[model samples]
Target: MTIPKELEKILEITKEQNTWRRKETLNLIASENVMSPVAESVYMSDYMSRYAEGKPYKRFYQGTKYVDEIETLTMDLMNQVTSSKFCDMRPISGTVANAAVFRVLANPGDKALIAPVQAGAHVSHTRFGTLGALGIEHIELPFDKENINVDVDKSIKMIEEVKPKFVVMGGSLYLFPHPAKELSPHIHAVGAKLVYDAAHVYGLIAGKAWSNPLDDGADFLNVSTHKTFPGPQGGAIFSNNEDYYKPVSRTIFPWFVSNHHLHRLPATAVTALEMREFGEEYASQIVRNAKKLAESLASLGFKVVGEHLGYTKSHQVAVDVRPQGGGAKAAKTLEEANIIVNKNLLPYDGPEAVSNPSGLRIGVQEMTRFGMKEGEMEEIASLFKKVLIDGKEPSQIKREVMEMRKGYLSVKYTFQDGEWEQKFSSKVIPMII
Candidate 1:
């Protein structure tokens, strides 16, 4: 049988991306990660073709006997990793999780305080994103330029003055730990809830490198599975405040999510278990690699942000690429060289500068999972220098990029060759043909 032209094109494009991205290029995208082989194996199960509209063991649909068990197990693993009493994995993305929590805590006309953009507030926390859509007024807390973070004292004052229903913390372009411990009390003092979006640093928290927001007095902690955590793409919300559970869980169902994407449960469970065993080692190396990459880039004369504060404590490095023709140009150049990074807004830039922002945000998590360390970070820095600084032709530099990517193809810090295939997936997942 002959394939249609459009279908053949789609298949060819898929093959090209698999070769080019998975096998050849260096991926530095901060908000992304790859799952391990075992996790991927389980993720391709029959769950994709099914639905379980409600909580495990309490489904709205039939044929959900196995769904209840897997979803329950997945929730248990999530609770263990995050050290929270209540967790819901119904939201399909971090933004949706944020939306459900935001709606549950604050009414449509209510006011909410958030860390300012420069201090690393994710878009979901801003008036331009979810909050705006919900009709809640989003206010930015004070930022301390000297510390490169939220101004705790000033923000406390703002919390009192604004009387916001909730306070939002965390970021898409994060570096150091936020003042969650310091701000959570003040937020509560004003009868406000503290919501921490730990999407970018869930693995670090599980590994015990970063403080868990719930322990720091945050009422709720929200996360996505595929950032530094290296799971399938999915979201979850965790909280120690049991009072908020029923309402928030209901909001997640009827308000924000429906079927809940059943396939994510198994894959997420595998990743959670991986973090339980190897999170500390994996998270620690991520920070080390990030710092090394920052130091290396700075040595090559790139203006790495937070230099005086030791670059970064997480798996991220922010660079001011203005001198190298700003972030958009620099990122495009590096992509041409098979090196990936994203254009990002810096503290000094206004919202108008988003299209041609002044900085580049880089994450070391994926490469860290691929087993690259300090020495490899230095090598990567040289590749950046060759493409962005020394003015080398990108096609020539891509050859070197592909060479470096060769040895690091195997994923680390996981049950890479586990028995999930023989024990479960073989029985559960059909061949799909």
Candidate 2:
């Protein structure tokens, strides 16, 4: 029997995207990463066709014994890597994870303080996203323009004045660390809980290259299992406080998520083991690549953000592309040249400029997953210069970009076949590298 026309079209488009994204172009999107073949193989198991509601041992379904084991193992490995006492891997996405915490931390019409939008407050933490949908009042903390971070002194004052129910820190396009350590106390003083959205930096935190917000007194750590973590696309919430975590765990189930995407558990477990074995090197290289790329961009006359604070401690590099006629133009031009990055809003950009802003959000996590290091970062920066500053033809640069990409297509920082097969059968979690 011949394939139907619609099915044929869908198949064609799927293959095209798989080839283009995997082998043709470099991916610089801060929010994406590739899963390893080992974990990916585990991803396409019987779990995809099944369901398991509620916790591991106490599932609300019957055909869930294996999934229950997989999920519990995933949570245990995640907890081991992140050093959290309580873990909930039920939220299917980072936003959902944030929503669960936000729900438990405050009621509708209640107030919450978030990191200044200019300094990287995720939309979920603001009145424009989940907070608005939930009817929570979101107050933006003040920015320290000189340091390109939240103004701790002013934020403390605001936390006291508003007496919010929760305070959110960390976000997209964030270059430096949020002041979680300095502001956690003030957040608690207002009868509020501090939440750190580590979605962007979870890998770094677990790898010991970045600070764990739990140690900084934050009540919760919300994360995307992907991103710098290089895991499957899912989310988990972790906390030392049972009161906070238990409620959020309940919220994740009956409210924000239902199926919990059973397939993600085995894949996530494999990724967590990979992080335990190789994450220190991978996370360290990501930071080095970000800094090197920023320095290279600066040398090429691109305005790299946070130049005074050593460019970046995380895997992201924020740049002002206004001279190249704003981020939209730069991002489009780069895309034409087979380079991938996103147009983003700078702190100074008004909410009205959301469509096209002065900033470009470039991340090293994906390229780092492909094993591109500091030297490749410099090469990438030169390609940016050639495309944007030198007015080189995009088609010509696209050829060079493709050629460079040919050398780095396979995923790195993951288990080799022989190594993983042995580990996959065992109950032991690897010691952190």
lDDT (10s digit) by residue, model 2, range 1-433? 9879999899999999998899989899999999987787778777878889888889889988888788888889999999999999998988999999999888899998888889888888888899998999988899998888999999888889999999899998778889999999888887899999999999999998998999999899999999999888999999999987888888888898889888899899999999999999999999999999999999999998889889888899999999999999999999999999999998789988888999899999999999899899999999999999999999999999999999998899887667666876354333332
Give the Cα error of residue 364 in candidate 2, in Å.
0.6
Error of 1 at 24 (Å): 0.5
Error of 2 at 423 (Å): 9.0
| Highest TM-score model number | 1
Global lDDT of each model? 0.91, 0.90
lDDT of 1 at 257: 88
Candidate 1 lDDT score relative to the true structure: 0.91
lDDT value, residue 252 of candidate 2: 85
